[model samples]
Target: MTKTAEAGAAPARGARAVPRSVWALGFVSMFMDISSEMVHALLPIYMVAVLGTSVLAVGLIEGIAEATASIVKVFSGALSDRIGKRKLLAVVGYGLGALTKPVFPLAGALEWLVGARFVDRIGKGIRGAPRDALVADVTPPALRGAAYGLRQTLDTIGAFTGPLLAMGLMWWTANNYRLVFWLAVIPAFVAVAVLVFCVREPTLPAAARPPKLPLRRSELVRLGAPYWRVVGIGLVFTLARFSEAFLILRAEPAGLAPMWAPAVLVVMGLAYALSAYPAGVLSDRRPRLDVLLVGLALLVAADLVLAFAPGLVGLGVGVALWGLHMGFTQGLFNALIADSAPAELRGTAFGVFHLLTGLALLLASVIAGALWDAVGFQGTFVCGAVLAALTAAGLLVLRRKA
Candidate 1:
């Protein structure tokens, strides 16, 4: 069957039934996110308060680590395409991430912390593209939107729960950040165990595999205009969104205690988990671009609220909107990439898409950090709002053109 016809075909399972591998993958993602967030929730404060790092430094570290992951995805994704061994690479990636868990609690210096984060993100980079491609490979395209949404929802559940766990541990340990970090190790290993034992790779016959590197010009040409359009939109969306570290920072002005800071992410994650699946379903039923516009609108509203809000209530509203934007956009973005890319090149398509967005993210974060240092917290979010507005306008025009 033609790629389009295959994608359009009725799902192998009913509307409510997703493949076991996808569920397993979602669980793996959930456990890892739980592990990661436990650290991430406290990491900004750990840097600023314990380690004596500046906000700019925190932004730089986050941007660089994430950008490194982005760069790695291009190679890892293409390699999986060439070797036809997605599961092995994914296992290695998850193992590497799991191994890095201990480094968090043990770090005595900034270099050690940075090294741990760098290595950890590399594992993320390695697994991300192939895992995404694997989801596309196993699930019917008709169900792609919901599949991505379900995984995201599960992941967000972990994302929020980890912070809540961290908050409790922080209280129980008398704000012992290191001890919380130590406990996070448990979930990371759980994620690895699930991936290794529960998830099975779909087999592909030798003849069906692509012969050359996925990045070669001839291969990329096959990705075509629609794929490129999605890539462009992704870059713009990323430019409007910076690292969430700033949100935690924003909460401080409203009298949120350092130990309670993770509550910000908890709120965001709750909103994200609740909304992601429905947004994915909405995207599947409506025009994808329209769904994207709704997401953009939420982000713009979030930025505005964060920029002007004076107290905790406003911050809560803004953070919740930010999460809502993530819920609305992130999974749908993955589905759109799947919709546009050919089956054979899905991994590389995700890689290239992520690469550009990563670069944009680096730029956005840097700008936000600089703004925070120069003009204040308000400047940072106001800039984000303006950028989001511009991007939304541009997308509206482009959608019209199309």
Candidate 2:
């Protein structure tokens, strides 16, 4: 080909590549995750060992915090749609989350800890739907799955790195949990800064920027059956998988050192990060629901492994499976929501989906905590496996219907 033709083709090919905003959003997720995970890796242990809290308390705290985030997404997402401005809400959310970082180190009582977690998750809630919607808005539909996967991959990188960093700092500070919490504050601010300076919002034409609220009955009807079906899948999936706090709790009895329990998250994060991008790329080419079914099977396996494992090796295997499940499903679900909803209501779609899943998580975590107290850890995991299997069966039926 002529040099002029070749040059022209190069620009056309480049036009199909993933956009810069997606990468920036991924980094934003990464920084926030690093900040959050460092505290999370140690929070359960700190509560149980230092603050003398019960396992039930840990479960309740994690469940409530996450559920709050889920419920909050609906409002924030709707607001973003109403304003036709995603980045502003995202900035507010990230800022709130960053501000709450200091509270963790200062928390001495369960109430303080719970309050801080609640506030932080509210920040998460504020940002979650809008940020996800922003991803869909900025990227082309053809690259949606890959875009979600890229974001999930970067976020998981931070997820794993935070725990790894915490593990190192734990030893450095002689297992000082508070000091590690203090250090976590740094990344939260960085995440906000990145969001402010790096990512650009896609421009909507003046005529397209209507002042309609997503909550209207007419708007709700427009969301349709496909979107609700996705919500059903999310609800069932969330019910089968409770907070990762339970995983950390299980690690000690599985024979990990208390100081090293954070390593469990590190392992999960590694598997999640490695698999996310590949899963995203595959989903972009193949059937999304098919990829999700594989993820569901992995979750059932992970639960069974955890339910009957003999030692730390078994636990690690289970954790790795859980990570793989996350890598396979999470991004696909996001892409599905983006695909299923109208471009204008993407924020509302994510919000409703998160709200349903969040409610399920609250119930699941509470039930898991109760089971842990009543029938021991084995029983809790066995319950998870059963729910996961049920979810898998449901997905199969849905796949056929689709």
Candidate 3:
């Protein structure tokens, strides 16, 4: 068979076996998540208690950090498409992230911390779209959902593990947040090493390579209606879900001690890790929109439970549901994007999707924080429930139209 034909051919065994490169990419994601989450699980409390920042400040920083990453993704993804290369950019991004790990522990002032976060998020933006596009390139079409899910699953494992480690170190060292942050540097470097030595980028078929400038109007227009529809749904979903930092904040008032606060992420991460792969596999078999609707319903339920239910029990249940919603939706969105966009424009599609959704998240988080400061956590969560419910209704309408 010709090279293009061979590149497009389906794997004989189907979704049962994915390429080794996909697994390597998954591990790369997992290790990086572990390193990042270790610091993140405790960063809010550190800013509040140690640095004396207000809740609104926390919201602004978190929102700005993520929005910065999303913005970078647009350019990095397009650049990857333009050059027909993904691995080099991925390496650069991951390397930047690894290099930034030490800054978290070294920062003594709030300004320093903010600077660190900004730089770190830029690295995330650089890698995010290219890495995702690379996954789509390497994996067979039939296994895209499974590949994304598996990557998410491993990433979530690191997400929880980081917090778990931080919690233990806190107890062992009498809440030494800096020490935990320092140790996190280890996994960040490990992630960079794994990506450098293990993951391999697949060559694109001749027909699937983009022109000189993938970001031009004509090229973007080729992304088509289906891709835009997925982007719309993704935007609404992001608006309904704000920063997870709020969950940690909520844990404090819900009766958890300061040192044990990371438990919130631990619970949430476990739920996410456990469900993501299964959800991915299921999405492969079922109508993806139907699966996504269920995820939206879970988000609504989580918000209500968080808003009204009392005590740690309520917090646990709500957080678990929130994690479940993440598991069900996050990978599926990527899978949907891959399914909708042309192979040549996949990186651009992911970049645009992330950029729009990240802006929505910034808006949502600011609103959530303002509500928390003015009324209380209950008001913030209740508003989230309403938005999630509305998004679900919108999805149903879209389904009907489809």
Candidate 4:
């Protein structure tokens, strides 16, 4: 079948259907990312300089947010399947998060800021997996790469713009964090509106899909024995992959100034944005495993560069490589999960995938931070390099067997 025909065809196994309206869902993500990155990029500054939150507290906060989001994802997806309304849930998630943005400006105490972050994360956890399932539902297996890449590209573009806008706002306002935060609310609201009016929910198979049995009892295991192996490989790869906070930390130690960190990120994001569409196209043409393995290798090289080399040049190379990997892997990940799993359980699968990766990232970041304190940057990269190398090897072995 042609790609378009394939997209409109029925899911192989009575999976709940996705509507064509689902395709434009990327706009929602795009707007959300813009709003999110704006706040996230500035949050450390606000917390440390303004609220005096310690590094440990920041880490704790991150862990809590990610773990909460990751764990809740499966439930929400399953619930959406049960309820037969991805649009409603998507609206709820986006709306709730947008509503929480004002809290940052309203927060006078450290506890209040934490509460705001928690609320925002709560919204994210609620909506994420269901959203992915919607994308999968509407598009066919062949189109999965394109759909996800389009979504990610939109999202990454937001990431790129949000920080730049925040910087401009800060410059305009003379670095008034409160004013900038309040302004963020505007975009958040716009995003909620887009999801509400613009995006349509995918159509589900008519018999009213049943709720997924909880974690241990999921029928998804029918995908087979080797399914678990892929999950394990994913987990190991995630362990080596830490937070991008490390990127900021690394760049500064190189010739990049601390204040210029966002600019560096912008550069990296631009690279990521440029490469994503082609990577997605590649995933569409070949096995997702190959594309994703290529991304891992690029990441490994980036880590190695971060460990050695001269000032600005080394930092640029590392950041660029990281961008390439991000481009390659993120979109390909969706393609892989889509290709490998039954459509009925897509949301649940993505939820599990994100949860594992998020948890791993949280742990890796903490460990890298501790390593930085004790063994310094060199030790940290050495460890990351080893993990990345192992990840690349594992991916290759998996491909060979395939």
Candidate 5:
């Protein structure tokens, strides 16, 4: 069947039956996240404790790595639009990511770790927009929010599972970081294999294909104002939410040991995984802006808790709230972009969205690091709360105007 026909042919069961390809892609994301998270859950602590990097250095590395990926997404996303294909680039990206997994175990120096991180993020950048576009391509409009939410749910399952495993391995190996890194390599390759075998790209109709130069000024202008508004919201959101690395750091000062640090992510991931699908379904049934407002409220609460609640209990509460906010917001934002953008420009829209948000993240993370260094974690989170409040206020004004 043609891609369009297949996408529109929803099962008799309604939105409960997401497409098989979407499910497969979700699993693909899950496995890769499992691999990536296992490494990341340990990385912040590893950098600070073993590698002896400063808080500011960690922020710079994390910011730069993510920003690099976002920058690459622009070109990769445009190329997918230009060529009328997405799966090939996704394969290459996943493959490159899998290949880089070993470098983490082998690297003896901070520079080597940074280099591997840079390359891995490049792979992430390459695949992100195309994979997101592919999801939009296969799913019907009515189910888009649910589809993205389900994917986010599965991805978050991996996110927590990876940390759970890392925590276990750390206990098992007597805190052997290298061994954990080595074992993380397996799931990444499994993710690549699944993407290659299970997921199939939808064929775009000739009329639905983008222009020859999808990134050309004239072509981009066709994305229209609504899409740009969504992009603007995304930037503000990113600016308010900085790197999660700081979460791990927060636990350390609260009396968490190095081996148990991954537990922070485990708490957050559980909250995120559990809430994501429900939040997505809620958006589909209700107004997305309402759901997003709740998310912003959660962020404000989380920041306040993180800033003043005191001790590990407070840290746990704040982190879980942070995860809940993520569950509510992340997939919904993607749905908003899909809802607003032209069908042919979906990939480019996601690319630009990621690029601008990523730049915001870089600035946010840097500022967060500086604040953490200059004043304390209290200042860092308080700033986040203030930003979230401001963003929420802005959104309320816009909603009233609308």
Candidate 6:
């Protein structure tokens, strides 16, 4: 980084603890994730017992939601640069998501459930890139990995808490799913309130910002070769990996208890939380190739565990490993985008990355659903394991090519 770039990063730096604004941003993510995961963690039960939803429906909702977030990311990120405010949009996104929380509690039909999901994802799409861009805006270059890691750590912590909360509610209410969902609104409201008051965005150069309008030559815009390769890794990996919801859904058919749902999810979230920040800090010096390789290998091993695991203990191990691998790479993957892509295009890069990855997830889930219907849980996982291996193999090829 140049002297000027170093100067540009000054605002992001504060006292050793990280600025109150940034930590608050982490809180916002923490609480919102808690809210979303509360419902998402237990959704499998609601679908299975309450609505009698099929695997295909479960897959479709997630696939659709991710696809929605992707589209919003492309334009909203660009728009934020013009508005010169990442913080406000983030608050709006959080607020929107919170507002929709009540819908699930009121929903009586699966379609309404899907509709609530859509509204919530719309909030996600609006907030994601701008929020990330805001973090970059305020964070010093040297702390980039640590900052993103901390943010990811907090986010996954919410994932951990949300499920445990859900589990408790389920047990306490004697399986009153609706009441548990109603309680989700509290954390979400807290997240939005935090964002509104505390998080701050530092003003920076437009080049250092996400673009305000359509990119001058978007398709032709250079996303550096190394970054492009990183995106490829994400895409292939996403193709192999289905959503966590699907994983939980898959476990159910194996006779896993609904009450045990939150426990497994808690384990996965803990694995993700423990690894994300360290992975980010490590990625700063360790070379993405090396860290990425280790992560891919871990995922391959995870898939193998899932493919062959005959019971709950084995299944838990596989899920936990999968979460660990994801934590190791998830935030690092975004940091890689920041490193390799130009500042003006960071949002585009992320959006494009999500587009490909989300689309792949959509396809993977849908395809997995069909396979599950045809051949059952084990068969679907056997296929997933093969695909994960293929994704790992692709990474090795990229390493050699680079």
| Tens digit per residue, CA lDDT, model 5, 241-300 | 899999999998888888888999999999999999889888888889889999999999
How far residue 217's Cα lies from its native spot in candidate 4, in Å, is 1.1
Better of 1 and 4 by TM-score: 1
Off by over 4 Å in 4: 1-6, 9-23, 211-218
Model 3 spans > 4 angstroms off: 1-16, 205-207
- Candidate 3 displacement at residue 250 in angstroms: 0.4
Each model's TM-score? 0.97, 0.95, 0.97, 0.90, 0.98, 0.92
Q: Considering summed lDDT, which 10 consecutive residues are worst modelled in model 2?
A: 1-10
lDDT of each: 0.89, 0.88, 0.90, 0.74, 0.91, 0.78
Better of 1 and 6 by lDDT: 1
Candidate 2 residue lDDT tens string, 1-402: 111111222221122366777899999999999999999999899889988988887888889889999999998988888787899999999999999999999987889988989999999999999999888887767677888999999999999999999999999999888889999999999999999999988755545443567878788788899888888889889999999988988897799998888899999999999999889888888999999999989999999999898799999999999999999999999999998988777888899899889989999999999999888899899999999999999889877877
Native-structure RMSD, model 3: 1.8
Give the distance in Å from residue 75's predicted Cα in candidate 6 to where it truly belongs. Answer: 1.5
lDDT measured at residue 22 in model 1 versus the true structure, 0 to 100 = 80
lDDT of 3 by residue, 117-213 (tens): 9999999999999999888887777777888899899899999999998999999988888888999999999999999899877776566677658
How many steric clashes between backbone atoms does each model show?
0, 0, 0, 6, 0, 1
Sorting all predicted structures by TM-score, with the top scorer first, yields 5, 3, 1, 2, 6, 4
1 or 6, which is superior by TM-score?
1
User: How well is each residue in 234-260 modelled by candidate 1, as lDDT tens digits?
Assistant: 998899999999999888987888989
lDDT of 2 at 338: 92
State the lDDT at 358 in candidate 6. Answer: 75
- Name the lDDT of candidate 3: 0.90
**Winning candidate number (TM-score):** 5
lDDT of 4: 0.74
